[model samples]
Target: MKYTPHAYQRYAAQFILDHPAAAIFLDCGLGKTVITLTAIRELLHDSFAVRRVLIIAPLRVARDTWPSEIRKWDHLSDLTYAVAVGNTAKRLAALRQKAEITIINRENVDWLVKNNTFDFDMIIIDELSAFKSHRTRRFKALMKVRPMVSRIVGLTGTPSSNGLMDLWAEFRLLDMGKRLGRFLTHYRERYFLPDKRNAQMVFTYKPRPGAEEKIYEAIGDITISMKSGDYLELPKCLTNVVRVEMNERERRIYERLKKDMAAEIAGKEIDAMNAAALSGKLLQMAAGAVYDGEGQAVRLHDRKLDALEDLVESANGRPVLIAYWFRHDLERIRKRFPGARELRQEADIADWNAGKISIGLIHPASAGHGLNLQDGGSMLIWFSLTWSLELNQQTNARLWRQGQKHTVTIHYLVMKDSIDESVMAALSRKDKVQEALMAAVKAELGKE
Candidate 1:
């Protein structure tokens, strides 16, 4: 197919091509892959500015996404590519093969940098946030070779998932710490205040007043930021919340556990040590199951599943992408809807895209990045809610982006008067901080 870029995509592609070291902070499903690929193609084939290109991405993405994109489009279809994954022999063989692009996972970055026999003029790191920690082996290894690459691009929608403290390592990879300072400690000292601390450990850090603005200004020249809504003429999205009420037996069990910090379920002693653990137990109860210390799942009630049944039935044959948080939930969902399939293979993606499958079950963390499901359906059901706003937004964008024919309708199943409500509030607060960087995500704090 001939490539046609939206105005924002055109700008993004040019921005990358013009800058030797750059970051594309584009929201999920906004065609960041195609944008970067087009820029690399121009430099490699048109301008003669670059020869070999190395693309470091998630494992599945390296194996599937870049190669798939090369095959799908007309202009990029001619580019030769190889996946440098698996055992040492396979990596060596791939490196020996003459190709314009080589894709490898982030885990093998250190291995590649250490045993590298050849040099790449261009490097693109997909999901740059993966290397936000300066102490990781991958980051350390990349630091050794950061100088050899002439053209570099750091790509991620959520650069600061936790807070601005995470940006130091990522931007350092792009400009050698020119914009974000040369060291993580220097960046932190200038813009952050330790929120919780003792003699040896800083538990949490908060941004100083006007720090976000100052940091944004520093990266304004090298980083190109674009949101999905700002670029794509997408269909309307209708987000609906479905709250589930537990039965008497379930309520008693939940309260006993919450009040006492422990309860007996299915003859097993269940307990939570802290607020985080307590939140987990509450989420499990809300999801109709709870796991003991021995990793046993105790079935609670069918309230959440009942809500899902209504959603799937009302879809009226339209495929539904369902997100689950636990293995027990997956098992139960399959038991209730026998035909629902976990997205386990490439063929499964094809089947969903063709609308041959009635429901595609996916864990948000697994299928959150670079998997195109927009053609599969216009509806998604969150059988379980996640506290991470990044996962929630990326998982939803799988179906809500450019190619859908109908208004996207997202269904959330929340157990009323449970930690489900609290989780939603926490996600909203987290979403607000991120929304300032990306345009589509708006926080709805207490709508529940």
Candidate 2:
């Protein structure tokens, strides 16, 4: 458990300590948690400059990730921390407990800042991109406490998941509107020209001439961005698709349902709400079940379940993290594999890391952030594909991140000629857009 950082991690720690108001635009799998934790440990013990510290992160991350990381390492193990989560009583009780570091979920930011009188000297915002929207209540609440916070650090992998317009609010939280601007309207008007394309549905923000370069130069002093491929020796990640094929009977049912747009199953009339709804039902059918209007999950053929059984059998004893889409899929999966454990609460995370759980089931949205699962497994099977690029990438990063000794393998279970194909296509388009955006920003930063 002795601590030894990679060269980039060491540089990141120093960067955080040196700049009071800064943003670490680090890629996934990089050790941002330990880097910031090391900086905070030194600030408290060595310089005696910081006393009370606060970390705002995702729900599960706040409850488990930060505290777990502190205990995992020897040098930072002595730092005391408490999780300010759960019901009102639990949160208040956690706040009352004497601790050097208080970690709270992002949802409770407004409540904690508004109700408490404590003036924290150091504040760390993990996954800063969560507050990209200027209109969110969490960002507004944090703005009220900015004057009292002495030092602030923002950390995120996809800083501009959407576009440059998202950075206005995040950077404002770090520098008190110095680099960006005091108001989002002014910031957009100054640097971005409005696009009337899809005006009713989407108002695009086009960057002003040389605006990207200008923005990068302005924030250059406080921000230190690092790419994962540039520093760490990342293990190769291999991707594979497990296609599920239906038998003659199942294919007849699927084709009839698709052709008629309505099918009766289990004495209930299952009707599509719209095109999107029809696609959803097809997706559900692909996964072996469909839900009716009365909130009933009608059972279908078990093609996907058979695929899962084969996958689990082939893996032998290696732990496999399975990401399911609907409640019915999970139920069917559990029935198929009686030993599979649900990735629901913090307690399950400990057992998973200890290799006690062989087959783990989790929804992508639940395990998408801050949980370190590299020690447990190297393969991820997507029982269903998600449309959101952020969730898909973040969930995969859990197993593919640093500390894993094996080349990560990701397998997607896709039903041919179904909505699964559409979901994969959508993700590809989104990935290209985000990659281009990141590349453009990186190019501008390199000019400096």
Candidate 3:
């Protein structure tokens, strides 16, 4: 395979060369892995300070991504790499060997360090957002081994979705508590307020405060931010909301359940405590899983299935990518679209991109990172909604990426006034909510 670099790849390679201690905030499906691999190759070939590279990623990514990337690029073919996913003894044996690159899952990093395994010259932390919470034992373990590593790189699309506090832990991993301070409490006091009413801390920033810009610029000094839309002529995403009407059977069951549950607690004071439980049961029923009087799941509404069928028909023979959330969703999708394939059945994501399969059904959480599936389909339909902006954006990028030639259409099937609508709303503004809470705290303090 001849090595030909895309424009973004070249830019990323240069950025890596310029900043040895920088993070790469690249979007999903934008060839972040290839860019990182190319950088590793350049580092090794140019005889930089880095000789051995350790890649810490998610379990599925560690098992399939690192080695696959090394094999894809001709330049990286000469590099020797090992994936750590076996019995403890086998992993230890592999660690003893002299592989130029080693990939391990983030979950196992603490164990590896605790067992005194071999260290590497450079550490690449993929999905760096996974380490956003400083309270985790894994974060502490990684911090303990930070000094021994020569170069540290953090990679993620959502670095600070929750708040500026997310930056604290990731920056700590990179430079041992330099940028965001040593403790989260200290960082919060500097840029946020402790909300006694909510028992939570919130970031404080005004439109013209210049605090966010200053923090972003400070981080930019040590990181390269890249967006897929910047370099890729991705297809236009057309989103359609399909509202499904529940059949009489479903409505009757729902009403009966609501009445019984209401009677069970009638005049007993409805509060947030019971309302939340009631809401869960309603959501479950809305998703076609209604509990019978005997507390068993009875089929309620197949409107979701009807909506999916309509979407497939509208595809007009174009390949479609379906994003499913629950096992029930998956079961319904598979039954309706038996010809559809899944992304997990094969190890090679490129196969899907190469048009070897049609109608790929993928779980957003599982399919929302590292892999590229742009060439596979240009249409995506959400079988259900989830309250995760990260998963939503990542899953959509699978088709709406650099290589896509057609307009990418995203279809969101939502039942009106149901849990689907609320979930979608939550996902759409999750980031804004965090920012709003932060601003609210700042306002409350200002009033004081």
lDDT string, candidate 3, 231-256, tens digits: 65566878788888776655665665
Global CA lDDT computed for model 2: 0.84
Where does model 1 exceed 4 Å of error? 196-201, 255-261, 273-278, 439-448
lDDT score for residue 92 of model 3: 79
Provide TM-scores for the models.
Answer: 0.91, 0.83, 0.82
Best TM-score among the predictions, by candidate number: 1
Rank by lDDT, highest first. Answer: 1, 2, 3
List runs of model 3 lying over 4 Å from the truth: 6-8, 194-210, 245-283, 290-296, 347-358, 431-448
User: How many Å off is the CA of 425 in candidate 3?
Assistant: 2.5
Off by over 4 Å in 2: 162-165, 180-199, 203-220, 245-267, 270-286, 345-347, 436-448
Q: What is the C-alpha local distance difference test score of each model?
A: 0.86, 0.84, 0.72
lDDT of 2 by residue, 1-448 (tens): 8989876777788888888898888778778898999999999889988888999999988988888899999999779888999999999998888688999999999999788876688899998988988788899999888888788999887776556777899998999899888998899888998775564654577889988778877777787777666666779999998888887776777787889888876677788867678888888988989999887889877878888888888899999999998889998899989999997876787788888999999898788898778888888999977776778888988888778889999999998777788888877766665565454434122211
In TM-score terms, candidate 2 sits at 0.83
What order do candidates take by TM-score, descending? 1, 2, 3
